[model samples]
Target: MNSYSIPRFTMVLAGVLMGCLAMAAPDQPPVSAEKADERAGALLAKMTTEQKLELISGHNQFFIKGFPELGIPQLYMSDATQGVHIRPQLSNQLEKSVAFPAPIALAASWNPDLAYAYAKAVGEECRAGDVAVLLGPGMNIYRVSQCGRNFEYFGEDPYLIARMVERYVRGMQDTGTMATLKHFVANNTDHRRRTSNSIVDERTLHEIYLPGFKAGIDAGALAVMTSYNQVNGEWAGQSRAVITDLLRGQLGFKGLVMSDWTSVWDAEKIIKSGQDLEMPGKANIVKDAARLLAEGKVAMADVDRMARSILRTCIALGLHDRPVKDERFLAKFADHESVALQSAREGVVLLKNNGVLPLAPKGTGKILATGTFMEKLPRGGGSADVLGYNAVLLKQAIAETYGERVTFVAEPTDEQLKAADVVLLSTGTLDKEGADRPFALAKADEARVQRAVSLNPRTVVIVNSGGGIQMTDWNEQAAAVVYGWYPGQVGNRALVEVIAGLTNPSGRLPITIERRFKDSPGYGYVPAGEDVGKGLKRGEEMAKPVYPIEYKEGVFVGYRWYEAKKIAPLYAFGAGLSYTTYAYGQPVIAKANAKRGEAVTVTCTVHNTGKVAGAEVVQLYVRPAKAPVPRPEKELKGFAKIPLAPGEVKTVTFTLNPRDFAYWDVARHDWSVAPGRYQVLVGGASDRIAGEASVTLE
Candidate 1:
């Protein structure tokens, strides 16, 4: 049958079905999941097979069709992580929106409350713009610094990423917008993303790749978007093991699972694997599914399941009861800009500092700012990019703060640098969605920094990038180095404020800054030739074959590998410098001995010994006294960011359960905590521990 005749036949079938389900159910206000399920089931009973098929597929690039005959409205979604993406088509409706700092910068803040507020602002904009679903808070782990989409995700540590992601989900969902936890499972690489398979073990997948999604699920996220990559040997969109077994059965996610734009390999397989929707409906996924159904390859029950899930999500989000109109929501939240500024302020990590920092605004002489990034801020590319609403450039911000004192120069001569009291060198690396970035600075940028530092002793370099960059060439010569990870719209304002001593830098390094690219675990593992099952076999004459990105490092990613291998990085994980000084006290455990599954409270006192008020992130690392299997020297377990006034002390406490110290045991097929003496270290950074305490688990 042609597409035109199919819709007419389904309309008649839908009328008959609606009559059968005409018995009205009790109405409930403030829609709950129970009510949503009931409403969804009623709607499902009334939808014909053709109508259900259309409802499950995209109506357009960014919308899913709804049954207008049953009073259901089409669901409108927007591509958002940093902020609501303003596409050319959406420019008329959404002229401008707040592009807050990237997710990586938010993660650097190490404050979940701030992450919640950040996402809340984004969600508010979604509502104002009539966008029901905001596809954001991409929780994929930052496995490699080179990954183009790294800026769109949280940091490398799963625990940290999970914590931030949960709050992000809560913040967005609370504002009546459905938050989508995207790029599900082992989507770490952008190179060969569509064809390459991620060969990861079950334990590694559960430990490293799945925690962030699990945290979002526990936080009640209503939507999950599948990744473009393949997990194991099957495409993520068509893998029943990943979609059905892991997400639905193990994690207990009851939300709509949609495919990435045109990412589906087989329409029938996606439906059978529990994937609910196919994006860009132009992919003819619905048409193909219909053909499969006619051939007895796809079941009507599968179609009904898909339609019901979408309805449930819509009703639960209150989308069904509301009017579908362009709200033209003005992105006019000054308060949100304040929140964005605060987030940017907290996320600015001081990698290096001498006495040259906190430049006194009163008598500071000419500040020569040189770099391409000074005038035009360097931001990640692709859909994550948003034309920010009134974004302040670094040069503009510096000039605003220190009128007539800051000079912008693309290339500074030795005479120009020598004449300046201080040289502010701005440099950055750019990464986006389609490709990974080269892990080092360009030769010209390195030359600029080296020349500036040599010409003037008091030179401060500001490095802006998605993740880490090779800073070995000129880091030693600079007086200070600050890592500003893709600061959003008002990031320039925050940057100037931090440099001028208005705000103290408190953000820590979320990922390890390797001294060189070759030192990384994934470095040199790229596919070169044909695979020999165990590994690849390089050959001069061979056909290019699809390669697999093996997770050989397993749980030993980021700091874990560096510590275990004893390869010192340029900057350690959880490493951040504050202008003020902090003193750490010995960790005191509530109980020296505890039985299995019992919670242990660990407390430590942090004193601000410096002259200024500042915040310190108290990090907690755990290591087993003895274990059967080899493990990293330590792993981050808990952390708390404490704001302290000069001469003030605060006792920060953390509770740890069995799971906190547990490892993913492959043999047991579950998390296992070996009972033995465990050392708990507390400090300002991961490698710079100041105090330690031991606990015995019986």
Candidate 2:
């Protein structure tokens, strides 16, 4: 079936079939856990088998059925990673909302405080829209840059992604909206995601893929959305090893686990595997579950357990006492737009500069801005897309700074290019859910960029992409390059400030820019046209099937791969240029040698050597001198982003615990640290280390 047909079927099933379901009552008192168990038990005892079946399935597309007769309120959820999505889908007068920068852009900021603030603002919008659960904060690791959903994730490194995910979960849950950590396990690639299986070893899975989810659980997230893909040899939503053994037993997660929309294939397996809910609650599952129970394939205790979990979550969130309606409430905060602007400004990474930046807004000659992206800003597609209010265009912003001196053109000739003092060429890569983007820019756009650079010596290229793009062809010829990853509603204002020197660029690269797609670790394993099974009929299956996507690169996912293979990237991870410069002092360790389980403090002083004030992300990486098993050459352990004025020095410190220095040991089924010599390298980027210190572990 075509992709467009699925939504229509879902709408019909949700709107028509479930419309007559009973409505929930309001003003029910909230119950504590002890009280909730008693109430849940009582409710379960009184509920008929049919009523119990309804509670485990979706009442509609975005809601789950509740026992209104028992004063239980229905749970209302909405798509809300960036902002509320329900308002735009409504048929009445559209509601305006604050669309903050994409998750990748926020990851570029490398500021947990900003991540928290960004999520808080989104949570507020969810509250205003009367959404109980915000299906957001996707914590998938950026294994491949071409993954269409990378914009919705944190970043490439597990440590960094974990820190950001933890803070984001806390911020969103604090505002009374349940945060959902999603696409659980390895939902990295979008190509045939529903049918593909992610084949990974236990060690690599523990170290590289599962850390971010672990962090989100540690931060007290209330719900987890299972991915559509299969892990190991079983579907994630129905795999006992994934949903029960790892998430619930190992990580100690006690929240509700729901499947992605229409992701369940087997009702018996899902119910027995501890997956509490299946989204949109397909008819087959609802009917099959009842049959399975009658045939002894599933137990009544399983149904009761699932109902109790949902009830516990509702009680904890106070949804039982104060149920929200589908009515619109005005946003109370006035400074949401300002927060978006600031986030965009801090997340725009300055990739290259040749002393031509910080251009005087007034004195500069006619500035010709050419390209499709000048007027059209690309926000990532799918659920992350929000039609924000008052989105400022780049041309409008440039005109605001250089009135009557800036010209907008789709295509420029030699004479037009020569007449202008500088050419501002805008380009972008389009991304959407259900599809992975090509690694290279469009041919026409690439040719246009080359022609503009050949005609004008001082050409500035601004890239708007969800993830890293191939820029080796014309990067050396351009005077400057800035990567603005889907900067949202007020992104243009931030673009103008950064280009005109009104604000210093401090954003860092979250993923490495490889010279070519083949240089990436997942290159050969990525799906091609023929590998995707495109020509099969609607009900046909392939004679010979390719099922598993083997993670051959293991723990060497992003920068770790480049370092291990000794391949140079077009731009390194954590590579970002600033208008000002910084100087680093030798790193100082509180104790040269420490016993196991003791924390060590590493301190270093950073001085701003340039004239302007700017922020620098001081990165600390650790490498074990000798390991019994293989490891990344150097892994990012900790970092601190500090702002300083010219000639001002401040000492930044990072504390390392036992877990930071340990690697997952498959034999013991836990993290293990070997006693040996360790090297601490401090730098601004992975390829540009400035200082190093050696410490021994006893």
Candidate 3:
């Protein structure tokens, strides 16, 4: 982050009078809904039925069909959960891109403003590729620790995920590039994702799962991509209950709804379900839709709706009028890399520190770098693996930071371990799309880590993972522990800076790290699978569940389950330490009593009590002192990130709405707040509460 500087105002009043005027005049304001519909309608009228059908499907693997004769530009799309996964050019050369930290990493930062900056940079990358729609900002709630796709999403809390998703959607669309909120609803685990059915209750769906999607839609996301799995016995892409009723009706999303590649089953059902687009250009959609319409299996009105959805989005976003491709941003990616570096700096969680971090400046001693990802920039496999341009590996960063003092060793002997001043064990396993990562590190990694920890207590272990991993094996013996989630491209530089004391670690754990995998709510819930459907895509398809994978834990995911069941985890949600310390003063409630639909304000003062300047993430947890129904101990309602110099204190204020205190009423089919006493807890993490106050809600 220090390597890049923020752009300053250019005293543009001198030149911007002409430049700004030119820009302001040429670019028309965003068309209203009525205007967008009229424009789309005019274009739709010019196209034939075949052309309309083509508009609803992809032309190439990542492009939408466009008519050059009609002056429409073919729009490209890309997989962009982490960064722009730039497609290969016609020459088959991969396009270079700046890789930002994973979504979970950004979520860990707990800075919505940073989330906006992180996403805006990525949106710029989308423009560089001329990608009209970015198949990203996947906000599915993290359900299991072993979920492979967790890195692509925010953590397990609905409120936290919603806040991040809202910012990300706004940031991407604000760049004039469309953002797609993806894997709509309950896409927790990637294992058997194509076939597994997530059996979630209505209340759990609304309370724990739907908030993130709703936030994205409310933020003006232009598109949504359907999940590959089934929900309540029907494929999510072809479920009217999920698409038409839940997404469009309840969430009020009127965007283009596209299915995951090869995810659609019955064309007739998809047409009726409001799946506006089938991706990767499937032939069955065109061929079967003709017959379905002729046989009255599908309505012409629904088909028109689907095609109109695509056209409306294109017209509304001005994608139909402008060239989708622009290489201008590629030259400016150094600025984006700095954003990635800043995200990594803010997201690296100092899990444990026994005065071993920020090791004695220049006298830190011979740094021993070892791990599976020592030489490679670890990333989630599949689409999230954006080949980072100028990505710094852990070893590379360590060497760059420490110079001649750094040494590379896969396995150090007892003598070597004893000889080194510090053992920097940079360890993590690569995550794949369809496979679930183990809750524990690999046996070989465990042994090496344990050996290093046992021999050299100065061992500073850096773990790169999507979520929690088995740390109990040797974490206690290690002098310090850091959870550096997939830091993108130049993100390793930030990690090194934190270790070098140049940057104070401020990230909090987005998800809880359980002491044991079995201690999780989803433990022993692995579905046994068999391929029942013919022509299932790949060999991995055999893992598809024949029976529904029940979410018996319901709304109690992550810290909620731990707090509710009284099972202690290795680390709590929102848990992370910093080089400096912070003290939270007693919270002041603006009002002792509150009614429905009113905002209640809470303020707390925080002081940087330590010697170093650092940032503190002030967390606000809302709890019902007495409730009529079952709920978790506390839920995250509001939060703020405050930076202070040593001895400096700042007061942070948070506003709470009725929805933050309400729970989904299953019987009433609406959110309801039972009249009760509520406690407001403010602190750094869920378990690290420092101050509390009470409020009455009637």
Candidate 4:
């Protein structure tokens, strides 16, 4: 079988801008899955067995094998969640990409539309680089603050992650690029082995870990990369229960499923598990897959299924007819830079403040800035690492903004600290891909911060990282504190603007900023190499029966754990201070009684009772009473970010849906909603609930 064609389905390039290779037009929709499958099956019927085997694996490091004889081009993929990942091998051949703010930073904004805009810019860059598949929108729930790649993921809650990721998937896919939701099912840590088994219960998995992936699938994500870790003693990539049973059957995801790079070792198991592709070029599968099939260990249907999925996605994305990489799109990166700037502006959270901000409108005192990464922009390391083409630095942006009033120093003397009206101490943790990072700032850096605070209680501490860091040590002493989570490229500008009152700080903490890392749910979660397996050799840590990472905290993740344990977080999840103030009115429920599947609407009025205009994130948390099973004390169900002018009052409403009131029922093997009274708390932040209303579900 050879030289097959499916021309009808190939030209459905409706979404993308025809000549510019730009983003999808708002009115023009992308091709349908049924059309893609139909076209793929037509092509698959004509492929030889050898070609079928080749179609399901990588051609090289970052490409899928193309069927040139049949007109399928080799598909290009890239590493990243935030931006077009720049690598020596990958970037050398293309224009430098915009280092969009890390998704964690974007998560801080709690704005779905911003997330969509952020991803659409990334997708445009993806097409500009000829990348057919953008291997992210990595929506793994942030389990631990120490997890190096937490920067690439949405924060702790399943509900928030789900909402953000759905928009992220649509944004990326809308630009004619395939959006991949990754590290499927309990892949949280980037510790030793990257294969530590995640010990999770069925109920916990559904209630906590699975919602984001389900949302992405529902949003029509084109690919899913299986996790490197094992879920219940089985590699997620090669687990039939995880893939075929849960992902495909339960979630009904028919898109392409691929293994993480070097994540699969067992060829027979991977083929049978319904993992459609082996990435970074096939090794284990290509060698022994045919023999396994001949020996009745694997079925030909499995191979056909894998090949068909990859083909369908490629055809559906119009990769066959469209040019994946176009130099024309590179010139438009300037246009995407604004989105990066806006994301940063919206995402840098002001953790604490005491009237020292808005230096522009009020005090015209000297600004003393001290920190490393003053000239060089510091961001997390590894696969998500993106180099700056024209990134601004903290010192540069501050100096550029405040000219002669700013004095910069690396390690300022006590006199310098006391002499200045305000101190900007820039500090953050540099997390990476293959390992966990320290939960606290380095001792010397901590000492510097302490010294600055001691000398001058007017220091405004700015810490950057993917997630929260230990703040109990000096946060109390500091006059003010800001959490700028690895805000990319133009992030420094946003920080300066917030400090200067040009842009009001509205970004909230997506993850809780713990007083101490030890109090965290994921405290000591990443096992050391020695903890992998007793008496196992150094290199053999990757072997099977790997030691499991027990999620001891269960459903009490982030703010839930803090509230449940009665531990006061330095700043709670959804905690962010603004230059202005806002007050909330009592929440009003549309109806006291509602059906299980019916919508529950909670409305509240927020008054901007401050001197300036700003955005307020109205968080809605659900607390159920008299439920059958154990539940978190409070779970974030819905939220709205509203911008208001000073002295203006605006009404904000949140609607609860079927999944909002349901919990994973282990006995039923499904989501079950209990008929009971549910409390809805609405406020600006999680800890600052100003209003509550009760709804009785019948």
RMSD of each: 10.9, 8.7, 4.4, 7.4
TM-scores for all candidates? Answer: 0.92, 0.92, 0.94, 0.93
Residue 646, model 3: Cα distance from true site in angstroms: 0.4
Residue-wise lDDT of candidate 4 within 29-53, one digit each (tens)?
2556788888889999999888888
Q: Which stretches of candidate 1 lie over 4 Å from their true place?
A: 1-30, 324-332, 529-545
Give the alpha carbon lDDT tens digit for every residue of 236-354 in model 2.
98888999898888888887888888666788998898888888785546879989999999999998888888877777767777745333335443455655776787789999989
Q: Estimate the TM-score for candidate 2.
A: 0.92
> Candidates 1 and 4: which is better by TM-score?
4
Candidates ranked by lDDT = 3, 4, 1, 2
Tell me the whole-model lDDT of each prediction, alpha carbons only: 0.81, 0.80, 0.82, 0.81
Superposed by TM-score, candidate 3 places the C-alpha of residue 497 at a distance from the truth, in angstroms, of 0.9
The TM-score between candidate 3 and the true structure equals 0.94
lDDT comparing candidate 2 with the true structure? 0.80
Model 3 lDDT tens row, 571-665: 99999988778999999999999886788999999999988777898999999988777888999999888977788999999999999899999
Residue 689 lDDT, candidate 4, scale 0-100:
88
**C-alpha positional error of residue 181 in candidate 2 after TM-score superposition, expressed in Å:** 0.3
Task: Write out the backbone clash pairs for model 1.
Answer: none
